[model samples]
Target: MEFKGAMGGIYRLTEWITRLAATNLLWVLCSSPFMFCLILKLLVMNQNLANESLQMNWAMAILAPLTLFPATSAMFTVVRKWVMGDTDTGVFRTFFKGYKENYKQSLIGGIFYTLLFVIMYVDYTVYMTQLSNLQIVGVIMLILIIILLVSMFNFFSMVAHYHMSIGQIMKNAVLLTLIRPFRVFSTMLGSAVVIFIGVKYPVLFLFFIGSVVAWFAFFNFYGTFLKMQDQMEKMKQKDEEQESVEDKKSDNLQK
Candidate 1:
């Protein structure tokens, strides 16, 4: 029996808050090593230790493929259920289940993305600073980096939603980013807003940033996927209708 009063509203609001907070907390906990390294890098930067900061950056890059990527994919999985209207799904059970199931693909994806990002960033720096005449190349690299960043968001969503190989997922993620500019920009804007707020209010990072962003990103990605499916269905129906017309004409001619 559903309660019909302010009490019900309050109960739902509290439950929703708890779900987001708990999921975010679990993500942070599972990816603690990466977080620790990030924090260390920030501290080093504040101290103006350029060499130590660079070391921390490498450490984060290495540790991220192992910890952050898988954990993030798992978080996306949890949020995917909620987006698909399974609000009562158990957060802990769903999160770890996603992590275990998607670990290999996520790890492979993480390594590839990490390496690509590092190489592009280094190239971007070199072209901009060392080879000043090739600034256009640096701009192109920057664009690719942005595209990659947005595609990475879609990567997590695809991991949660699709049962494709890593290669297929990566190909589609990049294709979707390039072809669906509206969706790509919308997801990027939403995530950037959430991240900006999360950064400004550090406390939110502990309980909302990661999970909320994952939910929003996956929500947008799923919307794009549904639209594509609808288009494919329409095309298939058109083909069948054309074939039916041809078959009827041939039968009439034969008669």
Candidate 2:
């Protein structure tokens, strides 16, 4: 009996891991184009020569959103559903559904964010050119801003998944970040490391690694959220059941 129980536990754990891995794989495949476009945008942004060709840079900037926004929005939607136990939705269906549903909002959000990023970049360049003394503070502020933006994106993705309004999503995201800073940081750091490795190697293995990382990060955020949501629901149910039982006992005594 003990051996059987232990074996069953192991099997269940393995199954859980397998499911997580499968979900991650699906997410990566669905979101590949967005990922590629994002990387390309980052590359262009990092290049000093990119600033020299204003038209080319603008073109890249414009294309980046057109290529990546809808895809990313769809990827997030699919991954959120998958994490919430909707295993029937295949990668293609999820991708298309997400893309179609979120196209306009994603486009608008992407344009807004991208414009903000460009403005920040120009500001940073101007500051760097003018002041050598404030470089460290500016760099630190830039890093903080990047982290905040990424967190906001994650929150918005969750909002999109849950069909929540942007305002509510932003509020919840801010609360979640304040309450669970470590988890948020871990997710971001893990994702950054994976992407960094992918970029550093830029070979097949690295591509695979980055894909795996992206998937893991996407699912991890949603999965953890779902688990917490489930737990809360369970607790609420239990409390209601207990209250009902107590009420029945009291009525019986009165009778």
Candidate 3:
């Protein structure tokens, strides 16, 4: 009996370790596609920072949205499954499936996002340099820009969780931002804190930065999605109840 109990404990221990290792491994794998493009974007943006070539900077900016969107889409796909207690699906299978399914829409979104960033950056620069009179306008633009960015934090995650068209997805994200502003701010703040810590300790970024951030982002998003879902359900129930009451009143009159 002693030997059997010992064997059972060992089996459980090994299983736990194996599950952890497998999860991290999938995260690492998902982060690969984004890594290369990230490096490219960094290099390009950093080039000639002192006396930057405008066209070259904007030209290379294209790589980021194109690459990051697809990879992010895939990563969230795996993250969504894992969070929802459905980790049995092959991680690779789910990752690539999301990448393929969300590719076109994500690309469009990527371009849209990148273009918005570039436009904002350019406007900021212009206002600072040449368009001084528009500084007030620039400040308003800055607020809009920040909201767009905060909204983006949950954009891909929503794509994983729902089946809206890209345009609708974008609109819904904006609505989500309006509805759950606090959650949106909290996610961005948490992400910034993690990223700052990772920056201070480069080793963290080396192995787990991408996955760690992704896991938390998905976790945060899952919470927000649940709240939104619950609210929607409540609204639906209320509508149904209202309709039923109205129907009963009509029936009484008919009788």
Please give the range of 10 consecutive residues that has the lowest summed lDDT in model 1: 1-10
* C-alpha RMSD in Å of predicted model 2 compared with the true structure: 6.8
Can you write out model 3's per-residue Cα lDDT over 140-202, one digit (the tens) per residue? 778888998988867888788888889988888878888888877888888899889978996
Clashing pairs in 3: none
lDDT of 1: 0.94
Task: Tell me the tens digit of each residue's lDDT in model 2 across 1-255.
Answer: 999999999997775555445544554564556555555656666785555456555765786466555655665665566556775566567667777877766666667667867877776776677777778756865875675566654654664566766556556666766666776777778877876776678653322553354455566667568778899999999999999999999999999
lDDT by residue (54-131, candidate 1, tens digit) is 999999999998999999999999999999999999999999999999999999999999999999999999999999
Question: Which regions of candidate 1 are displaced past 4 Å?
Answer: 1-3
Q: How many backbone clashes does candidate 2 have?
A: 0
Best by lDDT: 1
Best candidate, TM-score-wise?
Answer: 1
Which 10-residue window in model 3 sums to the lowest lDDT? 48-57
* Model 3 lDDT at residue 114: 83
Q: Residue 124 in candidate 3 has what lDDT?
A: 74
Clashing pairs in 1: none
Of 1 and 2, the candidate ranking higher by lDDT: 1
Error of 1 at 137 (Å): 0.3
